[model samples]
Target: MFPPKLATATLFPLTLGLIAHFTIAQATLFIDSEHLPQAKQYDYIVVGAGPGGSVVASRLSQDPNINVLLLEAGPSDEGLLDIQVPYLAFDLEPNTVYDWNYTTTSQPGLGGRNILYPRGRVLGGSTSINLMVWTRSSRDDFDRYAMVSGDDGWSWNAIEPYYRKIEHVVPPVDHHNTTDEIDIGIHGTRGPVNITTANAPYPIDPHVNATSQELGNQYPYNRDMNSGNPLGIGWTQGTYGNGVRSSASSSYIHPFTSRPNLDVLVNATVTRVLRTGHDVETGLPIFSGVEVAQSKTSSVFAINAIKEVILSAGAINTPQLLLLSGIGSSSPLAALGINQTVDLPAVGQRLVDHLVVANQFAMAAPEDDLFEAIRRNETLFNELLVEWERNKQGVMTNGPANHIGWLRVPEDEQGWKEGEDPSSGPTSPHYEFLFAPGFASTVAGTPVPPTGYFMTIFTVLVSPSSSGSVTLASSSPFDPPIIDPAFLNTTFDTQVMRAAIRSAARFVSAHAWDGFVTGQAASFADVNLNSDEQVDAWVRSQASTIWHPTGTASMGRCEDKDSVVDPDLRVRGTKGLRVVDASVLPFIPAAHPQAVVYAFAERAADLIKLGRHLC
Candidate 1:
């Protein structure tokens, strides 16, 4: 096994280059069963090589005695150039090779239209295709999660160290070594994930400043969101080293690829968990590992987990796996003709995803339209690609929305105080406004603006009240689940979204945008902004997902009837089975969940190592 990561977070440019350069070379970390011994048992079997599973496998394999077998449903994250570039996340999202390409079941709230829901299908999972924004939920949310899970280990204080342990903060290029917008002590010197500022933060940071000024300090600005208070305008921090995307496969797995005990298998699609026996005491079904198949028609192979079978297949697939394995609610299992081993009715309930809406504003400076130059003109893009390949610098290395603003739903407009900001202070932002410069009109059916220079403010609901579910579409494990995150199902959620859109509209109208913004897009202008009802209607027609889904296989206190997993991440009625992904998050944090998932997996590794869930 490899030694612990060096105690220093400081890395010279040469060290950084070596790490990014050889990321794909570590694909040797994966081994097909064809080359393996006949022995099918391993000390620990981690399902999925996403952020959570990657961390667990790497850490558990640290002890040479512990053999870790990580199974990935997709191909290895080798030679995927889009997965390496920070900005290319947009390009990767629509591709089936990198994303699961799941869609919601026609939402009644969203004008009964089915929205495309992308999940990572490759080795690094969603991290390989995600926009790479890095930040955790509010501190209050973690504390609340602890309360719901009945475990102090789920508390912010309990998980903060893990956050620090897994983080290695890198400053933006030319910004020096100083923490630009990050708070002191709130970051780490050494951990697997690389957090750094984009080389170019979209050229519209001045607009962020002007918008904040127009707000008259009523909302003020947040200096650093990662430090517990995320309410304010700040430069977005991406999970990157210079410009190369720092995926879990790259950060956690690649760093320890030489570890003999850690074996990863790619292109192994798991069908379900296996139950070979039952616990003698509680009579809970004992997990015997999992069944894998090369394809839907391939012969099944059962791999035994000598110790435990941990599901890190993310929120969507984890619950599906449990239900398919006869470890879920009796009613659903009966319908599918699958015998129920566990009556956990809450396995696929309470699903949540961030509902986002975008407003397009016309930018007068046609010459300043960045997308036209890079997106349409292959010559310009090629030049930028050359710069990125050479030094990992330039606009090609920039994540889409670099200047982000976290705001609470302020209670004010036209001498009116709505008093509707429900979240706890600035530390817990309720809304997110992502500034995308030269990002007007839809290009290729995405939210991108038309083929010209236009600025856009994508308003997002960070803490939504509405919830949905992931249910079986059929009895077959190969069939996709019915995802119904019933976006804006509740009236309160609708009100919050209305407030968010209006607030974004106000920011666009700020005098600061006067010189650049000529007018609102005709699509937005067609709406009746004068009436609150029309604004709500407009939002209902246009809202889409921000791609953060959680809370399906939620962790909860014993009293919670809908809870599927306990605070220990073990299913309610099973032994030797645990979930270690976003599925276990009792509630979606105020920020993105990628960081939270990494941190929780660290705590999970410690808990498992210490035998916290011993039978």
Candidate 2:
């Protein structure tokens, strides 16, 4: 076990150094509303300290002459053990104070279920609470963005460097050499966010790898999925180092808090983007100002940005803020008594999210079921927690999944509408599978069995055909927006999910798992796997989100009527305001979106710095 003192000793100097630096630099790191100067104007005002805002604010403030202010609606991420621990990620959502705790409207496709949607509300945003999976998706995913926006900057060739710029590969907690596990040449050694593989090996790791080899080409063994070709079973990479979560706040904001030009304000919510004036030639409204308040009833504060106001409030809140500011469809704003600021009707449309369904199977080797053992035995769980706190090595250092697989539906099997292929290209995945060595339930309120050991295969529809929206529930900024991800709404999405479930079954049916493998768990025992109707019904009943939401404020050509933002990520029919987050993705990448968001923000910072010259 690592000595507890060693961890403290390592952090103490860093803390002290930050304090000393702040004292010498005389720079304010955090500011409350009462201390904020009313007359001062900032060069840039970034709303929401998520991956997008954090990178943008940090990169922009690199220029010593630029002053940046970042506003977050939630509390600080420091000292939150739940946010820092990778294994504790599951405890931070679904009505936690650190989460937005929003729920989707009832959906017909989900058997009239209202899914619990959790978005991070802290300094690091969702990166602090997410499962920590780091996937950049496929190369074609970026090329499609370039093709749709008519800008080569978003292509894989142009954006690949940003991925290297955003990641810093670190050793896992166990300190084992990862030469064969991942491709070090493809990752960055000197970057802000730290990425690593699972620390201690799980008992099922060998079985999974063996199955990959036994199952032939369809389940090919991928040495590193993050190498722009994510098409097979490979080790899962995460944004964590030394058993500690490396969130956006920790990577981008916390390290540079002592910079004199940057100021981060927690518990300060920007209610609306205040329009300052109209452009002399284009007649576009200038949204260089923002209305902020500590609470819904607190005193409203008006702040101006001399350069721009960047919105990084995730997919849900970005559109909500725009709609509240009268920048959405004019018809709805008129009914809500809000004067029209922009006639763009696509602000809250095109919301896309990955839907997950868990297929659990009983495991014959109960002794090797680490996750089930921990859940059943409190003493074992406490001992493991102590082990992690002491030496940062144990099950606590990893998330639920140890490996992930991205696969495309066979070309002949694709059941999409004619000429309506949703995937970016041939390399893009139609669905994904996360292999968890324990019962992994995406749906809330599902009870774990008391005695039996189990493993789960999480089937995720990456290229979803069904789209939804984020619209105003009320005119008040305090009200939560009505979100409708519309999971499994289309026959195409349902067919893809059914295929994923069948593929997962075939994966575990390999000769390598003859002894250890058991039949399906009780939850899915009755479902006829051979029947498409029964399989689709089971999927609809069990489907929930992986929490990778995007495309609410999608980027496209300026003349595209359905696009909310242009290729530069500027809001249509508006000036001096832009969006830099997952919300700007026209389509959700065929993997987790955190890594993509980081790269996007890195590129966005360069574009914003280049200004009109690039636009």
Candidate 3:
């Protein structure tokens, strides 16, 4: 066993540096089973090395006495150059090695079209492929979950400290660090993950900023959204370190790669969670181990988790893995030729995600052409590349989707919060607008014919009312599960999005975008500006998802029979099994869930440690 000090988070960076520059292989354990010589057991086995799994494994292994085994189905994030650059996330998706690139079943609500769902198949999971924005959902989101789960301490105030605990905010340099522009009491200064705001130079689009201000002015309750209120136009803050993508791997996993007890097995596809008993009358199945097949060798192996089997395989994969292990709906298990051990009817229910639209507006630039920058800027490209290589700063470091705004549905809008509920009245939030500053377009087929230059506003409907589900594709572990978000299926969801879009269009007409719009930028020239039907029609055709899938295995009170996990994050009917990922959320947060998941996992770790201490 290694010393506890060597496993500390502060030492992680140095250990990772040693692995990257000086070491060949970090360390290896010998496992010589009769059928599978490579099969091994660990004190804690975390499936999927995404944000949640990475933190859990990294922190748990720090105890020195505990050995952590992290298994990822994707290839190693060794030399993915685009992964290092934030703007290049778009280009990296089509590459098979880096992204899972799964598509959902044809949505009945989305004109019967299958939406392309890109998930990071690399070490950091979606964080590697995702736009590196790091906004947390409003505090009400957590309180709502807590209320549903009947867990008192699960509220935002109870968990907000964890966000600060894991966060290490890197002060902005020059104009980029808008700390003065936004509030900081709610943010953190010292932590593991680095959070920074984008300051890449773009002419201050008056219309965009002015319109955003107007919306806030008109909706005074939402002014200063970034001040833990999240209700107006603002610059986007994200997990970018001097512009390079700071994914969970770069910030969490990679930093601990050299730890003696933390073992990571990449490209290992887990087949099933090994369980012993089937009859609940007798008892819940004892989670013995995980059966996995090596991607390179196609050889099956069984690895045991001596203490716990935590599923951080994400919303889709986590439920599917559980079902394969005989822990899901009875009907589906029987249909797929799998025996049902635990009839958890809600293993893959209550799915929710943010539906977004790439609102494209054409603009004549003052100097540099937009298409020219994406297609032909050799000098600019090379200069930015060299700058990043030398100093880790530039446009290359910023995500294509930078700058965000948060807003609430109008009082007249569907699902609008009617005068503070008599039972559950006034509430505070972190932020609501998920704004970005790149031209948003479809990625399903060959890219749309490019307009010369445009600044697209991707307004994410974060607090969506529509919910969907995931089901087995013939119970096969290898088969991709069927996911249908049923976007815009509800009148409440549709109306809320319509209000958001109209509000955004108003902002475009505002002064903030005046200097930015040199030419005609409106796409809907035919639609009458004042007509509600025209705006609603435009919204229906244009809206798409922001790709933040969650809530397949929600945490809830005992009364919620469909809930897969308890508020403590333990599998409802099973012992020694817990889920510590986005799937546990009862509802989608009003902001991005990256920071929320980190905070949730931290609280989970503390709870587990507390339970152990009592023992």
Candidate 4:
């Protein structure tokens, strides 16, 4: 060990050097709030520079008169290799620079364990960290939302234009230059977010396609799942443009940075909304701006909004923000010595997420192993990384998992004997499947296999009867919120999950994988396949989140008292405040929520511009 004086001498200049690097290189993104005026005002203040907030802020800033302030709690996405590469999302899932890294409040449904939930803390939010799977929910799902929210504007037909407006459709996965099989009219050509096939073909692609056919009539290959109905097997469409990850920041925010009216601040955490006064009799607080700081120890300053303050801080943080600002239940805030401004009881209630149970099989085809080709060999891996860095091509261009299937619970298992016409799609589906060609240990964070190649199958329960909440752990915004996504609380959810696991087992054992899969591994070997009791036990042990959480700050009709927001995404009792993220969704959609969240924000920009409930 070095002497005390020598240690200090060795570290002092290095500390200053690191500080100088950030001060000079990232001066624009890292705003020196301490030096700015106490309360610099803008026309609109967008809290959370995620998918939703970025879209709204970008569109609102299009008008030169409307000054928009976009704030993110993390650093910029620039020069972050993991953010640029689509396949590196798993590396940022937990305890990473990009994720907020929140955990559940001891879930009683999952053996009373706290599970880690990753929400993007970076400039693009979860969009930069997500697998970039681009798909929408069922049309009936949105129409049902329209009915529940007491507004027809949310109907699928009404919202379809916004869906097109936010998407720039490209070619398929296997073919780069041609759009032969792609449905042209269903997608847009000039949207910011690029929507295309997960494009790079894998060694196991043909096997999954062949297996889909071998499964007989149950799982047919779908022409295009994005064309309203999603009840079939297909190659996943990802949010990718060329070979790079098409995140919300790269698509919406960075492209429009030249606009003089927009100001984006990274590493700025929002503490609470600044309320100026209250509505006379209603007691609803009139919003002015948001108070922000770099961290708990930093000095908090206000960024005043001239027209509105939008919270797109995602499902977990959005409700936590409302609670800290005295907009939640009276009992909880009063106990914390916080005065209640708007007594909305549902601020942190009715939280939902897509919980999944995964299974892994030992790949018989050792020659086509991703673990061997990418991770095991250093020289080849470094060369691939170099290729990706130089031209943004190679294996790094695709996500870890690609083959996604939306399927109904089998008729025999669910006690529904009749098969409905899928042309218009079933009203909804209970399960979705994601197939991957990699070691389960590497992708799903499980114990590594002793040797050889492996593949994973995840069965996700899309619609669950049970729900959870995100309550304030303490009054301090520095403390993380209580996220309890009470998974498998209901018998139906538990039963459906068991069926989903069984379906995955059957899919892996099918003739399509006869030469590819040698044997099943992990929990599958430990549990008795024939017994329902054993399967339920296995599900409780292996179930994890797909990271799609919503409905904490839900919108509903006035009669729906549990609703925190109104028909037009406004906080029920407050003026000049609105929620335009996944939290505002009344129920969890039947598909991944990123695409839906983008479309919601696109329409929200128009509604906020009109200053009405409907656009």
Candidate 5:
């Protein structure tokens, strides 16, 4: 259920509008499992409707002759107001029905705490519930992908056009002239997904921008971070326009739902991939179909794909589905009483994610606090909601932060194991800072203070050396996989985080925030930031994932023994099947992955269309 702050009457109309629009105009495009024909087949069967699957499915369906089926394990993203409004993003996760609500294995690094790992169980997947920060990452990140996968097609130069093809820069909700805020020439003006800067100005925005000027080149002002050079403080761009969240579903699927060739089934889970036959030439098992069911006990139905089965169930579920279909390590499958169809030992290995710690401080004045005030005062919150619903303006038009910075630690100063720096290149950011004008806690159920103004600076370790794995808890698809990100497992990762926290402390020390900041608040009040040991301890207790999980089913050279998928994103030792999603990224990008995923999927659609001829 949605929060009580939003009136049901206001939300009912939106729901009714969606229902009427879909059912009357495009009834054939959306199918319920109860009415789904048993022998129905399509040209392509896309497993998940995230950015990867949505792009692939939508692009493929553009050809009227090529029919597409996009399956989502969750409900539709029709009228979920919390998901629609940018400011209410934090309230839609953890234990909500819109989230997967999986918990990680206890980690010794975080005092044996089981972190809450939330994956969106909605139409747009994680993009439907994510914070919506759009970052293209560094140019070197894509070049590194090309290097690892032994394919020049994955290079930054080759993929830059795809980034342009995926973005459609729109006016901010406030309709402020974005003259100096963005670089218009670098962005795509007519793309599917909408991108924008902060809709309204925040009190902390100018201060953060001024700090970049005060700090000189160490913290420089980058007018545009998405220009393939994301290495400085700038306005945070998001996947939104006119105060509405522009998700993969909203951008790629919903607008195209009227297409007669595309059929999307919600609440339909693909239980496992099914091997149909063997290829005549390679003798590799041909996996051209999948078994889907609405529930564990419901009727199981096998759906075949004439062309290919594109797996885009994201990092966690993609690997889990592969293992369930007898395509993982032999020893693990033998223990689970499952047959090993393909002895691919690296199916679920190399899981990577970014760790963020929130550093909070009490604000000097209460009147400047808008977020905390909205959280505490129901009347103000409702008023803001009405303002957003009537006209896309006010704080609800934007997210928690207006500005963000991506910086790298000086190479000579840091401690490196065997002198190997984990970053892709000199331009890649090692850490990031997200400036929030109000109290922000990553931990679930943290209550907002009853009466005080606060600000939080999120210190994120973007370039983590530590890696983890996603393994099967059991053979049953109903059971969730054991997701162990292994956060701060290595000293290198912790060292980077410690540097990020110190950097945040130094950033606020600038004269721009002299009267704005009073002192450290909450957990930081007792701990001394000057002591290295204390800061490390505080990080261990506060660190949590930003929910950008990738690389569980990584891409590599075709002959590479450890790689799960080849350069073409085709599953190794399998024919007529490919894995597209965050799972196929060989290395996690040094920024938010939604924009990267969108670009990767755009390129993947071309590869799928051109087949092996894509150079």
Candidate 6:
């Protein structure tokens, strides 16, 4: 097993360094109670300092007159070291007080396994804990969002500018410049967030390259995957600057925290939204302020909002916060002895996340193995850290899994038939492949190596047909909520996942890999090959999520009773209230959520600013 603290020490310093450099972005925020004016009102109050919250805060505060308040339950990320390196995220662990440390209630299909889920508890939230890959979905994904929200502006064309507005791409240097082989028109240059491809000393496994090329050659219209159309396999673009993570706090919020109008409260846990009087006669209620309790303190205080309340608290927290504030299923709240303020039945419904079926195989040789270096000598490990800290170049700066692909399983295959998008454009697929250079010996820890040096080809099922729910585990705000992801609950989801695993393995076995693979010292040949049942079993044993959870407070058309937010992201039936986060996505985005969340927040900030002008 890998040393536990090895990952933590390597990643922590970079995390803190980024935070100290970026806390100024939240300068407009009022962190102390003494700063609040009598019955004070602000132009906007954004909760949760994650991707959406930070972006909204950064963008809305651009106007010198507008006052923005950003509240986060976690303490400032300052001085936290492990979060800085891109590759050491796994070492931070569920034990770190900065993690929410959520666990699934029970995934019925995975034999009731309760997997550990970690959400960032620091100022930047999960973005600080993420892999930092800047991946975008196919254009159709946004078009579908526009269709669901009844808004024409959500299409790919409508939001591309926002994506470009938040990114600053570091050009490829040296032999790593595959700019000739891939498309670059889709990337941005002068944005708040810095993004770039790295040329870490790690060599691309010849087998991996040949296998991916073989698949592309077999498929038609196999364009570069990072292009607007993500059909073929390619290297992943990452969100990093000088080899360190570029979280929203580090990129967008950090630069502007010195403003006097902004106020940020860390370690404040909001119990519920305070209501003045229940419009009992009309069954409608008005929210006045939010009740917050400082972590490890009994002093609960209420902070009132003057103008509008925004919930950018992420998919899980946004909905849960709503329900705790008596804005959820009436019956459930009543049972918990809480009076219902707003009967929004869908508050905690529609939990969606990506599911993956990973296939692991033994490498033919261990010469280039990551484990060989780290395990063999402490100096090699220290050198890796120095390389990242001083030069911002090395394995620590790049993700162990640096390649990604989008694939369409044969429609005739079992589960692939059920979740087919009738509206899909050419080259889009319901399946994705995330290739990594290591395997896991246990689910509770970092990537493993004793399986004799292996690679994991994880197939993710996006747009899963199955739906799940998030509910109160108990009446208390401190109690963790019940999360039922319902993985593999649908026959179609399982079928497509199985096929994806087979395809990934088949590519490795093909003659195209004969020259690259060589079969010399391959470790996993003992396993059964060319059998669907065997592939299915192995998939279940190794699969893991890419950690993209969305749709808890999904947006929808005005008439849809289940909708939590309007297309503009306002919480229905409440004034001066809105939710600008991943929870607003009606469906999961086709790619990583960090980029899209940034785009959405940019648009939300514009809407908030325009609305303020009208007032």
Count clashing residue pairs per candidate: 11, 1, 24, 1, 0, 27
Q: Which candidate is the best by TM-score?
A: 5
Give per-model TM-scores. Answer: 0.91, 0.94, 0.87, 0.92, 0.96, 0.89
Q: Each candidate's lDDT (Cα)?
A: 0.77, 0.86, 0.67, 0.79, 0.86, 0.70
lDDT of 4: 0.79
lDDT of 2 by residue, 421-507 (tens): 688888889999888777767667777776778888899999998999999988888889999998888888988999999998888
Question: Candidate 1 on 1-615: residue-level lDDT in tens?
Answer: 001111222224534565576574755755466755566458999999998899899999999998889899987776566678676566676546777888889888887978888899988988888888888777888888888777888888888888888888876654644455566577886887888765774556777776777775744566667776677787777888777888999888866767778888888889999997888988878996799986788788888888899999999999999989987778878988999887888888989888888777678777555665465566666667667778888876777776787777654432223444434445676678887776543222644444446667788888877889998988788899999999888766777777777777777677887787776664776766668888888787778887889988998886666788877787777789999999888778888889999988898898889888532
- Alpha-carbon runs more than 4 Å astray in model 4: 1-30, 34-40, 172-181, 279-283, 415-427, 441-445
Worst 10 residues of 4 by lDDT: 1-10
Residue-level error in angstroms, candidate 6, position 285: 3.4
Candidate 5, residues 1-615, lDDT tens digits: the string is 111232333455655665676566445445576665556669999999999999999999999999899999988887677789898886787778889899999978887888889898989999999989999999999999999988988988999999889889998977888877899899898999999999988878878988999996679999999888889899999999879999999999989988878889988999999999998988999999999998888889888999999999999999999999999999999899999999899999999999988888888898666666766676787788778878978888897689999999866648767666688997799999998878877665666666668888999989888899999999899999999999988888888888888888888889998999887887776668778799999988888888989999999887787999999899998988899999999899999999888888998888888877321
lDDT of 1 at 71: 91
Looking at model 2, residue 615 earns an lDDT score of 41
Q: Which lDDT tens digits does candidate 4 get at residues 1-615?
A: 000010122324434545565456554454666644345568899999898999999999999989888989988876566677676665666777788988887777777767778899999999999888887788878888888888888888988888889899866434564343346688888999988876677777778788778885877787667777777788888898677788899999988877768888888999998788777877767886898989889888777787889999999999999999999899989998878888899998999999877677778777676744565566666666667666767777787666888888765677422442111236567888888776553123455555767777778888777899898878899999988999888777877888888878887777888878877765566777789899888777777788899999998986677898888888887878999899999888888899999989998899888878541
The TM-score of candidate 6 is 0.89
Better of 3 and 5 by lDDT: 5
Candidate 3 RMSD to the correct structure: 7.0
In model 3, where do residues sit more than 4 Å from their true spots?
A: 1-40, 173-177, 204-207, 212-215, 219-227, 277-282, 366-372, 413-438, 446-451, 518-523, 526-533, 612-615
The count of residue-pair clashes in candidate 4 stands at: 1
Backbone clash tally for model 2? Answer: 1
Error of 6 at 424 (Å): 5.0
Encode model 6's per-residue lDDT on 1-615: one tens digit a residue.
112345233444656666776575344544555565555456767789999999888787788888877888887765455677776765655678778888887676776677776677778888887777776677888888888888767778898888778878775433365564345577677887877665464433445556655665633323345455777666667787666778888776667778656667777787777775444554545575787877545678877666677888887888888988888899988888877777789898888887765555565556545645465556777788788777766777775466676777664654444435532555457677666664433245544444465555667887576778888876778888887777777766777777776667676676655533433123234446466666556545545555777888988877777899888887777665788988898888767788878888888888877773211
